[model samples]
Target: MKLYKEKLLSELQLKRLGEHQYSCSSCSYLDKFLQPYWNWLVSKVPLWLAPNLITIVGLILNIVTALILVWYSPNAKDGAPRWACALCGIGLFAYQSLDAIDGKQARRTGTANPLGELFDHGCDSISTVFVALSACIAVQLGNHPGWMFFQCFCAITLFYCAHWQTYVSGTLRFGRVDVTEAQVTIMLILAISAIFGPDIWSTKIPGTVMEMKTFLMITACGIAAFVAQANISVIFTGGIGKNGSSVAGTSVLSPIIPFSMILVPAFIIYQKSTEHVYENHPALYILAFGLVAAKVTNRLVVAHMTKSEMDYTDLSLIGPTMLFLNQYFSTFITEYYVLWLCLVWVTLDLLRYCYQICTEICDYLHVELFRIPHTGNTNTKRISSTSTSGNTEKNGTNIRNNKPPRSKKK
Candidate 1:
């Protein structure tokens, strides 16, 4: 008996230990970091102090930066004054930090619904467009031709699409941990360098060949292109399906879709590198024409297949075509128009994400339909029934009286 009891106790302890181990292994750092802040913000702040408010604040700051670069400052023709440039840089930095905070707050407070993540990323995307437009405005103020704005627009689109493709494919990693912090830092530095004049800024290298802005843009673009190609390869080769199945291509031409997707961007990047052309250079305009040709040829090859047969092939083709079109638009669009367009795209995306989050929250709570509770009436009725039953028992009286009690009814 003693041995059995000891064994049972030991088993209970082991079970608890296993449960604790599992919990620790599954703990998320994001939850830990954001939870406290979320609690404090919600409890301390006014109802009006919400995530959207933070987004608006960030947008306002971004717009102010753009306006300062466009209208005021003696060096508007070259860029903004050193002070205005500094202000813009500071504002951008703050905006990014707050952008992060809103999401963290949402997650920590158990409010990390899909809508919050969507709203946060949507805001981020819009902010990206705004930043690009501001750069265009600055460039225009600096006496650069209006066409340069198109280049900025293209760069933004490329970045956005690359991220989107990666997100969809589940291969999109942002920084060291596959988050967006590193990318944001890179963007901030690029913005700062542009403000300071790309040519004038130099790092610790004894003799670096590339200017700061040029190097930043090239590096960011190169990374984006590489990630995009990797996602395309995974998608087309069916190397990894969304449902975790491997798909074998039935036709020899099936592989070509992903092949072109990866190769075309690669060829463009290599061509740009060898010719010493930046992403926004006139060369991209020519490259866009070539990509369009490639896209048309690929479509023609797969055009004859049945809808179901062509589904996979079509999926592969869409990304390349979109990339080409994006590049074309970037190369051809006017600066002033591109900036506003980007801004509008960002705003709409943000709103869509917020709505999505709210819907998710409602679903999670299982409160699709509103229901009211009558706590007072239900509690009062329960209490009255209990009191009457107690009184009947004490008085030797049964309410039902189906059978006689030994001492009373008999």
Candidate 2:
């Protein structure tokens, strides 16, 4: 079956990185000043280790850190333990360090490949959910459900948008203000929270009822909006106007399908967690964030590999729209029932898209998704293996036909 494209092309054919120089223009000054230290740390990692392995280790560390937070701080009310927060901070620092060095390591080892790029981005997606949920627990934002969801949504949306910029411009353009910068800043916040105590973020602003979480979420929203707009401007105006490439068009409402599947369930799950049955287990909310995070990541990865322009329609747009509308009608109708109906419709649509994308990728690559090697050598092997075996068999049969068969019979 023909998938999005035919004829398996090597990664070289799909090259998008011009000059192949990896630089983060929007990197925070913190990362910039610390570059020497990060370089020193990368130099220490043994040359024998694969960059992809380093990425996997970073992903594992992130998961472990998140698990520790959930175990220690089940409820936002109980507050995260000092030790737990410290452990998370350490893990975040380590993950960030490793993530940074992997590319350098790959370049040093001469193993830089498309698979490594895909692996790194995929892990980043998963880590986004874990880190966001951990932040919610650390800050006890679970008690403030809206803020908790908002943080997760904002973080995930920003992460996806960064990659979407790459899909549009054929280069990963880090905005003058970017997520990598925010990530380091967040690490600082985590460290501060660990040192001061979980209640630090909960402290009220002077002369106002709003807490730190509110201020932070609002600020995060502003940053996310700016970053998103910057990307959209590039996609619609700068890149497309120059190149004449446009994203695949679908019905206006179709873009909402995958997003609703994610956010609708998110609202339901958040509401249910607030109820008595799930109140103590706020990890349920984290799981909800994971669903949306995975969906966004999946979309980004597909766009990157297929080299297709991603539709500008994103869940981040719909989320705030629904959030605002919910406020006006919240008292008049049972939101749960409305969410339940949305849940059913969204789940069906999401599943359908997931199946289509998965199958298309598998068919296109002709390799197990997980088994695709970092080097494009696997494609070379598949293309030649059959011919190599056929030549061997043909040679053997000829030998038999000439005289080898008679010798065997005797």
Candidate 3:
């Protein structure tokens, strides 16, 4: 706790945060078709249920199911049980349904704010890593680590680039076949694995000598490359901010340094390892690096919303640096143990950053994290810091407005 004594957001950033609005342009073909279903699903949720609760629950479900798969096939090369794959499919579907409705729940309850957007995207950055990992395991992609590395990093890169574009243009853009399609395809792949077995992915294509899994990997990687290029092109075409800068009024290309710091070091460590560290423990290696990537992505989201420049330097870099230096020491410590230490370090760092940032935001907005301040009934006295400070500020554009009820004359 002492580590987070300093404020993460500056006064200027906090002031500009109120001016931020969530602007998204999604041309998702699948989501367009599923609109009515998503609307109907959210309608079933009770009024008292908190939006952040909905999001966290979905994220937990996704993580738990993915972990179940990891427990069985830690290396991704081992074939997982049929039941586990089926369970993962169900869990992913639940997560998708619940994640889709949190925003609606917030709006319905009059608790819509920048916090909701930040929380939602923060959940997504982590979820992307798990989702990609689970898909790789489902296809038994561990046998081919080269493809596995490309596939997992490709997914991560595309996710980062999407938000990078948002940081530049001040609007999130989605093409026709984006996240929704990829998720649905993965869900189906898991379902097929559960039914026909993981070995089915090794079968040759109907008319071609290529394996089924290879085709899948190649196609997904190609699509990811195309999308990432599109994002960079949007950045190159210039931004929507003043003087063609990012939403934070910084140079549009500035984000490249932070992200490259992550990807470049990861590639170097993976290739230069004398003990074949990543090849021996693929899942653990990916998860550690994935968490680091997620942390950086979350910072990018915050910078865009706060209209503040994102610092390329981060404490999370300590994890990668430790590994890189360990390899340089000529086997001073077993690489496996070092990888585990790296994972633990990055995880705690992520949690700490999230806690401090959310605490600061909640205090500033006079709102609670998961609870809606009840103001309709006078006798319904819910006493807490959030409730007491509910009347702090109700005029801000993107901040929540907590209002008490008016009295009636007899």
Candidate 4:
């Protein structure tokens, strides 16, 4: 009767989680210039507003705008209204801004903890799904659905691998061109669609034969490849734990299995549907699978944060399983409708997982989800974002601090 009442964390998981501390490092190309803007913006946030609430608000803004795009161009074949394109850009910028500020807000309000790290990254996992899908639609990439699939799945994989290495090395690393650079690039693409119409992505280059969208796709995938390589380099170089073990003392390669399970099924389901389930509704199709990505990615983040081995059994698999089963049984159920059913199922599953997990974390840690612990200095002076950690925009919000932990008292 009470799904939220379910306990997702075991006693050992709780113990390890209590000992976890956030550690991450980022070297972004634009953090220096953007730091000033973020500092000025957070200064205006009411001290009384909870940091988690700020994160939720930003995620809502992103999801709502992304849904608006989906409603207008569900198939990704049609050109969305110019205003919607611009609105998506605005919404994404709002998300990036608020997300970056929430972590800083946590520190300012004296509330930065493992919960902030977990909460922020959880939102990022979901946001990454929507961000990739919205960008595909903004480019009207429906004509090249395969490329669109590549684009969306590529983003999901990048986010997953980012944390995978974090699990291995006990440090979240960001290259000079990472999440911030990617978000800004997509925002610029959305803005271009708004100004010149989605057709701009279809235009031919001046001297080359490559279409603008193809060019963009090549560039995005190339950068993703580079980032993924960086992650793998860390993995191959060995973990920070004893005998090159991951932080959890698990096999460095163990994470690959769980991530592949989520991804491989999506590909098989998409390719096997005789009813053209994906072609008819690319956005919905990806949203279904994307939620699955979000679910597992969150688990990986939790695994890293808790420094515990992850159990790969997830309820979100029910969604893709429904689709797989429907196709295997001679399409007893129409795939288009099954896709819808799948989307609804995954959404609820993700919600259920997050609710149960967050409740457990909050209770065990004695933390509040949407309220600051100590209320005072309704308008206290905030830290200068410029001098603070430059990579604060990566994890869930931004780059996490990489400073070594203070030695515990004897």
TM for candidate 2 is 0.67
lDDT score for candidate 4 against the true structure: 0.80
> Model 4 Cα RMSD, Å?
5.7
* Overall lDDT per candidate, in order of appearance: 0.36, 0.55, 0.80, 0.80
Per-prediction TM-score: 0.44, 0.67, 0.91, 0.91
lDDT of 1: 0.36
Query: In order, what is each prediction's RMSD in angstroms?
Result: 21.3, 14.1, 7.2, 5.7
Q: Write the per-residue lDDT of candidate 4 for residues 93-157, one digit (tens) a residue.
A: 99888887876676566665566677788988999999999999999998887888888998988
Model 1, span 1-410: residue lDDT tens: 33112121133322222121000011223323444554454455343345445655765786577456545422223444555555666666656545545533332222222223223444454455445544443333223323333344344444443332322232322222122333244345546555665334434334766544455455545655654564455444432333533221234234345434544553453243432232233223222322332222222221211111222232223433443444556545443233234334433433443454334433433222112123233422211121222112222211111100110000
List of clashing residue pairs for candidate 1: 77-142, 115-357, 174-178, 174-179
- Clash pairs for candidate 2: none
Clashing residue pairs in candidate 3 are: none
Of 1 and 3, the candidate ranking higher by TM-score: 3
Return whichever of 2 and 3 wins on lDDT.
3
Q: Which stretches of candidate 4 lie over 4 Å from their true place?
A: 1-5, 374-410
TM-score of the candidate numbered 3? 0.91
Candidate 2 Cα lDDT to native: 0.55
Where does the lowest 10-residue lDDT sum fall in candidate 4? 401-410
Error of 3 at 124 (Å): 0.2
Please identify model 1 stretches exceeding 4 Å from their true place. 1-48, 70-77, 133-155, 170-172, 175-199, 202-212, 237-410
